[model samples]
Target chain A: MEWLQNFLPLTFDRAVVWIGVLCTIAIYSLLYRENPFYRFFEHMYIGLAAGYSLGPLGVDILYRYWIEPIWVQGYWAWAFVVPFGLYLYFIYSERYGWVSRLVIGLLIGASAGLFFQEFSSRYLVQLNSTLQRPLWFSASNPDLTVGNLIQNYIFLAILLTVMTYFTFSYQQKGTVKGIATAGRWFLMIGLGAIFGNTVMARMALLIGRAYYILSDWLLIRVGG
Target chain B: MQPQTIWQKMLAVDRRLLYVLLLVNIVMFLLVPVRMPASISPPVQKFYDTIEALQPGDLVMISSNWSASTLAENQPQLEAVIKHLMRKKARFSIISIEAQSRDISYRLAERVTKAEGYEYGRDWVHFGFVPNLTVAIKGMVTDLPNTIKQDVRGTRVSQIEMLKGVNSLRQYKLVIDVTPSGTVPIWISYSPKEVNIIYCPTSVMAAEAYTYLDSGQIKGMVTGAKGAQEYEQLLGIVGLASRFTNAISFSHVLIITFILLGNVAMFMNRLAERREA
Candidate 1:
């Protein structure tokens, strides 16, 4: 038994790598066909992900923010925060469901209050930027060259047409319909660009898995 | 049934066969000894310049909110950014809203920083996972020490020598958001206006962020692994981004080739059907 153990010689790190390799193969096996092995790993992955989050939530959030403050720092008022948050679970109880709305109302109020600032900082800044762009070159805008001026004009045209496409208050007729059609074309092109980027993103994910297999598992020397 | 034409047969090829082809293409390119340098995009160049401008000991905040699902895209970006920060001798702290991201970024930063002889708590720190980004941002803006409370190591934020004078988000020179979510708007909304924000978004999120870039809300961006490759080129380092570049580039080419072929086959098959009619 001792001789066999010595000969095999599996370290903790190598075992981890082996398990990772197994999991990867199991997950990717679904590409061939749906099977029990794939479903088992898929379920295991979801369970592990959920369980993994609890560790951080406990250590980083509950311990640091809730428990430690009350116990160590003597911020006793902090103790109620979690219980209050947990009140949301009361929504499952028919008789006590009214208790849940108290938490819901708090959340909605906070979000609405935050949105006021979000609106000004987010959309207002963009609006200001759109209005500020120079359509043509001028001495005052010395930094803005002919190329930038042309680009700015194109941006303005796209912005207006896209907004026109979204306008549903009035009936479309003649020139308005023509502009809306053009807007739809522009939107299609924009969505196409986004879809192309999405493909690149998905491909990067696959390449990442390949890198892990070759570099980490197979012990091959990929580029730095 | 009528005998199928070559185009019709091509159109009927199994989907699994295409998946195998892509897998082969990626592995082949990944193992190729040859490396191609990427042309630097304007956003990546700006991202570099922003870090280059950082003075030694200038504090920076990193919002790393991506999990293993986006490891290929976000990992390279995070690593390149960390290396650049170390080179600039900047002090930085990482925060994550995604629970899984907290551990991944923390461990990745630990490995990278250790290699560079960057001391934890002194040169860099991790704030761990926050459940809510908006509340966390608002709290940090008001009172950083009280909000974050402690580092991942259990050291109080105020006790960390590197963060001695840092009591609010306003003190940080810059904020780098490495995420695959729309968390950037929250940062743009609530973070101190004085601190400049740069973004590293997965390719899918990159399109929506262009408006922010145009508005100068974000100083710059690094879009997924392709952008990371460009950044690695700018940094003159051959990190994971460099390794993955060939695979990503060639895979795109393969996809385009197959798309064109499929379209042609469909067109020819339609013509044949019309003739039969």
Candidate 2:
């Protein structure tokens, strides 16, 4: 702990405090108006991120999809080279833009095939299971707590009401209307919860930035 | 409509004021260090317990799929989990779907694991980023060697000392996912049924996971930064997650206050309309 305390030379760490203070000041300039310094870093952050992502991405695509085939598999896998070569030609010739579509089409097809199965298994199965639970099941046998029982009943209600809200099998009947009305209330609760969480998350981000300013910069120098 | 009250009028603060006040709260708290114990959510506790109970030499698969933006939350969770694994002497491998996570988690793991003298390639190997999680999982399931030709640095996976006997997901005792995305389902869907899958989702990502948590599809979860803190407590190590969550918990209280205030303002506005009518 003491080693870390003195790890940074006092002069060096003090110098760090100065730059941190300057950045803190620039960050507060965000309060006044958009300045070049702020915009510079903002765009630089974006550009750097894009560069980082694209660099690895370029290497991965060229290595896995192109170079590996040529180097490892040799001329036997050369058939893939033509379309791959064609996909790269769109930059030089506008007419070859359609060739890029072939690549896009394959991407879309693969995505669709995967997502179709995902959509069914995740969404459909979940929805169906929501509809089929036994309403009368006890939460606890001997060891089951009252809290467990209440949770089960609440789940049962939410399931039935929410499902009925989507039902359109026949003209609204008495039970159906009651269920639909219940679903509407449940929907309101759900929406409110979502909105609350969203606000919390937004505030969290702001807090993080403010933290960088006050704690990392100001407090560090002053407290030290 | 009801008559408007004075307190109710105050509730209708401007949206910008709400935002500024939030920024202030964050700034105020960040300057101060407060340590508060968290109410351990079931899933988070389960995640902690699982790692705590692991025996030495157990193999774990860690899928880290978050990036720098989520560093405030996900970084702490990754650090705590890795620290726990190191303490347990667990042999592990990390693989990522996102390219950034591959580099980030690799560096993070190397730093923490090195502190414990846990040798890389022998104890833990980073397979690094793959373009597709599903295809990778399928390949790792059916044929580990054919799918992953090389590690992140172009070394063969077969040759990596950590994965010497690890042919498939079935060989790993636990699969821990630290992500802010919905990639958990892919693991549940593709990984072998024999291996256990646990989760670490951002706080906002936790609610949707209750459905899976209830069904036992995911064995447990460490939710957001707070969950990371509880895990730190369980391990007897205070780290960044605990520090960050102090602000988060207080932030939760602040947001709740504003919501109530807003509702009060809306109620008053309705009452004023009634009175005018």
Candidate 3:
């Protein structure tokens, strides 16, 4: 018993790392073949993630916004906010499903209101930037060099072609079709670039796991 | 059945073998002591310059909204950004929309700050997790104190020594959204126009952000671990990104090789079938 105890992690931090190692190995086991170890850890991870969220939700959100205001701050009006939100669950009740719409309507109305600002803030800035690009270098825009001028021309060309591709007003024929095809090719190239970045990101994640195993568990110095 | 051709055998290779090869490649490269130099992209350089321009004690809001799922990409980005901020002697406050991020970022920042002798309340603070980004940004824009009533430690935001006079997001010098999510749009939509916004998006999210970068909506960007590596080069310190650079770069080469090998095998298999026909 003493020997077994000595072999086990005696400290809390060490125990945590031990569990982390076990979980990591169990999760990665699925790469070889589906097995019970992977399934067990997978389910445990989902359950733990959901349960862990409640801790922060209670302390940071529910307690701070809902409970504290009603109980401590005497903002009694804030008390009904949760129950009003819970009205959304009425959708499950055949008789009271209409009650759910009240919450849904509030959400829709709020989202619609938010969209006004969102559209103006998000898209308008980009539009302004597109329109503001100087196609040719000038004295007034001395900072816009030969490289920037060429970039702006390429950007505008792609922008128009892509927009033209999505134009559903009429059937694209001859030159319009040719431009649209070019747009499609450009989009494919963009998507390829994105996929390339995705591969890089996935590799980084694998490297991270390997680093953990080497540096944390095996006590090997990684990356010198 | 007749003996299978080499091309057919290559085509029928188990996917598990590919995974093992990738794992081996990453592990081998991770152990390699050689540090590769990164070519700094314009966006990464701009990201560095934005922080370097920050005067001492200038307030910045860090929207750290990434969890352990994106730890490999976002962790190094956040670490490098935090180190840069601390170097500039900036007083920053972090807000997390992701629940796990609140704890992860807070713990990470604490560990980083501890080594640098950075004080918690006066020098930096974590406002903890807020459920919604859109509503939170709008609230912080109008009333920072009332919106974020308390820090993660339960101290009132108004009573915090550093935030005594800060009541609106407009007062902050900069907003840095360190995320793997699309929450930057909300910040762009609602944040004070005076404050410069920057981004640290995971590589997958980086492609879509170019339009914003072009628009100058975000003053700068750091796109994932590779970007972080370039940033570390600029900062002249060997951090996690610097350490992980060799592995990530080499892994890309490995994947490209795999792709080319698969394509060649397929082409050769097709040509053999044509000859047999």
Superposed model 1: Cα runs more than 4 Å off: A1-9, B1-3
lDDT of 2 by residue, B1-277 (tens): 3335665547544566666776666655655655777777778888887887789999999999988767767888899989888888899888888878889999999999889898988888888778789888888988776577677777877888877766777888899989878898888777777888899887667777778777666778887777787888778787766666657777788877877877877787678869979
Question: Against the true structure, what is each candidate's TM-score?
Answer: 0.96, 0.82, 0.96
lDDT of each: 0.93, 0.75, 0.91
Task: Find the 10 residues in a row with the least total lDDT in model 1 chain A.
Answer: A1-10
The stretch of ten residues in a row with the least summed lDDT in candidate 2 chain B is B1-10
Which digits, one per residue and each the tens of the lDDT, describe model 1 over residues B10-101?
89888899999999999999999888888899999999999999999999999999998999999999999999999999999999999999
In order, the first chain's TM-score in every candidate is 0.91, 0.60, 0.93
Give the candidate order by descending lDDT: 1, 3, 2
> Candidate 3: which stretches are off by over 4 Å?
A1-8, B1-3
Best DockQ among the predictions, by candidate number: 3
**Best first by DockQ, ranked:** 3, 1, 2
lDDT of 3 by residue, B57-148 (tens): 99999999999888999999999889999999999999999999999999999999999999999999999999999899899888999999
Q: Is the docking of candidate 3 incorrect, acceptable, medium or high quality?
A: high
List, residue by residue over A80-193, the lDDT tens digit for candidate 2. Answer: 665774795575668767877776787788888878666664566466655554445455345566676677789988877988898888877798898899998998998777
